[model samples]
Target: MSQEMGVGLLRRHRDFRLLWCGETAGKFGASVTAVAMPLIAVSTLHASTLEVGVLSASAWLPWLVIGLPVGAWVDRMRRRPVMLAAAAVSFLLFLVIPVAARTGHLNVGLLVVIALLTGTAAVFFQTAYSAYLPSILAPEDQPEGNAKLHGSASAAQIAGLGSAGLIGQVAGAVNAMFANAATFLFSLLCLASIRDREPRRERTTAHSKALLSEVGEGLRLVAGDPWLRTLTLFGAASNLALMGYQSIQVVFLVHTVDLAPGAVGGLIAAASTGGVVGALTTRRIAGRIGTARAMLLFELGLAIFALLIPATSAGAGLLLFATGGFCVSAGVVAGNVIKASFQQRYCPPELLGRLTASAAFLNYGTIPLGALLGGWLGTVFDLRTAMWITTAGVPVAALILVFSPIGRSRDLPTAPRPRNDPGYVHPHSEPSPRSH
Candidate 1:
């Protein structure tokens, strides 16, 4: 295990620190929007339960729509420019929301448009950012870098959630979006300050491969590799359930639990403190129990508490929601910490963008569907019953991870199986980078 150097990276690595600050700012902004956007739809636009689901779905729909091509594009070009352009687009989209709202022009349809456009930007930024990280840091420092990044993101989420409510209550949800817009500018400034440049992409004769063929190569890499396949499948299932509940959680807290709009943010912020706890403890727990086993403990074992969410009522009962949400956040973030380290070590650098996009396509593609499902269920049955159905699937989804090879081993495989083996090439072998 690496020594807990604490401030070593922050103090010594200039470029990493810039990237960390940028990412932290971006996440904080996004978390605030996560709460404020829903509040706008519910409170300002008078969006129905179903419309809110559609709004949530729209934000993630781009993953399904543009994911494959974006991955291939990220692999072929410089990542930083892609990230810069994406951040700029997100900044403009968010800036327009409050402007439109103040002008008496905001509506559910417009909100969906903003969500879709911003999400499209996210597709580019997230894919490029994932691929860009390794370029900024040496292989040995990546685990430490990832821990700090994830821990800071979790902390930012907590702060953002806490502040979103107070800001929404005092300033109104429309103006609160100004804060999200500001964070993007902060991110852009930080990104611009980074000193390290990516090595020029290596060129090769393999450039002749069709773009679709390149996309197919990435898909096959994940499909043919057992470790990647299991994790991808588990991610898809887990996200489906996670998004389902998330899409309607605001409705449950406000309408079902009868909480004030301002109180919603604070309670959620309190629950998200668990993400910070999870990120901090993941390395230690993995060191104690091994990474693969720790994954099960995090995903399958602790995730079971998600059922307690629907059981929440008022006053004392809200504690049930808080506790359940806290456990779920902790488990999910801890598992993510383990997974990020595993993927970075196991996969080839060139394929990281496509691997991230392909996996996210499976993982995040379901978000829209889950949002729609949760909304539909909430309308047909009731918010509380919908909550029950959706939250229950969270633990049940973990069974996918448990039954796969992840459950049988103490650690996930760090290398591909032998070439002649079933889980090995054609696609498992790393491909040379080519100018498209």
Candidate 2:
């Protein structure tokens, strides 16, 4: 990589800048929807705990259903066009929510459908975007690019969370839904404006086989590799616990903790600031501590603090929530930075889409279950009891990493190890980046 590209990718690369802008805008919208959707269910529709969990589950259910196929599809086509289509689809889906609300037709059922459609769009866009990043920037520049994108995403999320609460307070939560629609439009424009286009990739004969076979190839690569398997499994467990707490957080804060809607948003925003700090510092921390050790530090050590969230209440007690949330968010984002860079560098470029999809399918697939578990626990035992169960599970999830090869290494391996190497295996010969 050129020195200019290495140090200032955002400033020097036009296409990357466009990609970053669109992704950041989209994340902002997602962050808004994250807060607004649950608030709408709780505040306007008067949804029950189980209903709230189902609502959250609807959004991620598509990942479990279509994630594998979508990965193969992304590998076959140009990624940008896929992302463009996904963005457009999400924009229309979100627009439907506010329109339905205005027409007095808004209901939990409609919200669930909208969530499913938009979530499907997210699966496509995110899968394609992950594969597309390495195409725009040199390999050496990727970590810097990832850092910038993640940092901005965190910052945007903070803004969006704070804005969602403010907007909900001022114009009602339905209007906040409209704002999320607007952010998708902003993402579309930025993405459409990008000049760097993907070169067309040839369809491999492997694609001619059954689609299931293609999907299996991707799944095998992840399942067969120790590094991928460990990280993916850990991600699954972590998300289960993370989403379990988050699925009912609004309900917990509102009914259990007795906070106002705006205060809830403010607290979430405050906690999310840790993501910004994590993204900014992940590279430096990884350099100092080894990447593998840093993963343990951020993901394992900080996760213990998640138990503090359920302990929160009025006044000084709220700080416990913020402090705990800050550590968890920072840890998660830091771990993601490490993971994203690792996946990009370590995996074969040809299978990037499928690799991402396979991992996400497993990682994100747990989300719906977690949401349901949280909602169920809240309904059956009480919200605080549910929080205790879920929050404590976060640290326990980290034990997977402690036992994996990551625990023994200073840094994660840069390349897949050849088969016959003790305890490590590379299932497929690494391929070069495709033209498209």
Candidate 3:
């Protein structure tokens, strides 16, 4: 990596800079709403825990339905406009919430619909952003770029959680949603400032595949890949455990731990600090430890952290929660970097968008199930007992990766070379002024 590229990434990489700023704002605001939304449903709308679970599922449900077709569509176009449109629509939707609430027209049904729309729009934005990232930097610089993205994401998670907690406490939940909406508006403005050119593809005249068939093709792509198949399974299992825990987390914090509502934000921030630290160090760690060892190390750490959750089942205070959060975040950051680097190499460029969406959809599809299970269990069993049931699955999920080649492989790409996949632009092809 060039010294100049490193220097420029701090604030240069104009497109990354703008995208980062906008996304960071969006992420932070979303974190606030993550807490506020459920809190509002429970407190103001008098929704049941199961209803909250359904709402949580509503947010992720779109991925299961529209994930693949959207990927195919996204692949055929420049991503920036798609990203901009998604953000704009989401911003508009969020602004409507405050107006409705103040007018006494806000209802539980409306909030669910809003959550669903926001999540659905987020799918397009996220997939496009992921696809666009690789073409932005040098091939050798990818690990560095990915690490920085993760770091920004972690930092945003922390800021969002903290801000949400503070706002939720001071302004009340309804007004707090408005504050998050304002952040989205600001994010749109930041996106507009980023001027990096997207890949120019001539509009294709090929007939589009049927929606379900496109979804099937995406699934077939993953199934064809040995590594991706394993990774997909691991991701699916991990979401099951994580979502299960998330389902009851709010109630646990409110009822069992006796911590104020703001404490969840503190816990999220506490764990996200580990993610920030891990993301900052990932490139160096990959260089030093090699990719395969890093994967195993992160997974083991994840399992240990998962196992330690039951220790907190006895109420080890906030320290236990923080420890769990830290390890979880660290493991996730390390694991994702490895997965992303591998995917960029393995998945064909023409199919990258769909394959990624397929994987995400399959993985996330389990979330609603887990959420429903958690809510029912938490409602029936005590908090500690419900937690035990949930935590048991974490080690199992982490260990599932042990059976995959990804956990045992260490190769990391240091160059962007063309293969059968010709749809991608090799950013390394053009000499950057910052090239070493």
Candidate 4:
């Protein structure tokens, strides 16, 4: 598709517009919760650094616990209903938080439970949503769709993060959760309004497979493919390092850097602007420098800025954190836009749900471990020392991409090599498709 065609998709496509709005709204709410949850634990309950880390871990733990099966299940059912249920569940769960705080019933344990349950809902919604997108847009339109959705998500996050601290300061941290709940409601309404319907999937008895068998197929698909394997590994390693530092960032800024709540929100919102830029420019960058080269530039080249995060201090030094964060955010978001488009085109539509879940299982599974590691490091040593260790791992993790076939390629492959092609090299000699 032409650039002009992609840019005009939102205007021409009504169902896609609804999907974009709902997804963007959902992202906005999640971003608000990201700031507000940690703030509540720190400011309202006086949570320790380790407690904050555990809280962060709780939110991602469900990915490890149920990711595979959920993917398999989602493929068997229509995606929209699953997303609707998940959104409803998330809305109610977020709604309960402020109520509990007001009723004097809020506690760390309750918070943990809420986080875990909401995370479960997120798993279903995300899995269903990933699969559902391909059904809405034609193959050529997917890149622009992914770019617009990711860009809008980043923009919504900026708005959410910018507002979170003001809400916290004015209405109290616990009550700020009301904003999150409201966003989910908006998302639900938008989703319910979509006019297009997904045709029901029909499975013959001979084609049916057990859940575990389906899960294994998904796992093997990712593991056996060179491109998917390489990208998945890079994502896993990168997230480990990313979440490790992020899990403790609030504590590092609040306690070590001595920033107030509102200042903290403003700084993070400033840093997140990079995501918006990255999303807006990714398609042009890939067009200019091949998609594979763009991935290397974004994932390996820009990630070097992570080292500056540890250099953050009180006043003038805070720019160090923002600059580093901006680069990392830009790189990660741009790379994701490329990757999302690649996957939509490359993978078989039948297995997209499984593919998403299987990849995410490995990618997000490391998050809890990273969070705990950050917490343990903070507890065992000091917060700054922990930050130094974790932030340093960011660029190092990209070395996986460097040693793999991605480093040598100009563009990622458009389709998987035929299974019967005996001449295929596991990580080399793959066919390159026309550049996006």
Q: Give model 1's clash tally.
A: 0
CA-lDDT, candidates in order: 0.86, 0.89, 0.73, 0.88
Candidate 2 residues 315-418, lDDT tens each?
99999999999999999999999999989988878889999999999999999999999999999998999999999999999999999878766778766444
lDDT by residue for model 1 (1-436), tens: 3444748878899989999999999999999988899999998888899999999999999999999888988898889988989988898999998889778898889999999999999999999998899887877787778888888999999899878887888888888789999999999989988888876665572355678988887888789887789889988889989989999998889899998878899888888888988888988888776677889999988899999999999999989888998999999989988888878877887788888989988988998999999999999999999999999999999998778777766676555344334375323122223211
List where candidate 3 sits over 4 angstroms from the true fold.
1-5, 204-214, 310-316, 412-436
Residue 218 deviation, candidate 2, in Å?
0.7
Off by over 4 Å in 2: 1-7, 204-206, 416-436
RMSD (Cα, Å) for all candidates, in order, is: 5.4, 4.9, 5.4, 2.4
Which stretches of candidate 4 lie above 4 Å from their native place? 1-7, 205-207, 416-436
Residue 362 of model 3, lDDT score: 81
| Maximum-lDDT candidate | 2
Q: Is candidate 1 or candidate 2 better by lDDT?
A: 2
Lowest summed lDDT window (length 10), candidate 4: 422-431
lDDT of 3 at 385: 80
* lDDT, model 2, position 183: 90
Task: Give the Cα error of residue 96 in candidate 2, in Å.
Answer: 0.8
Q: TM-scores across all candidates?
A: 0.95, 0.95, 0.89, 0.95
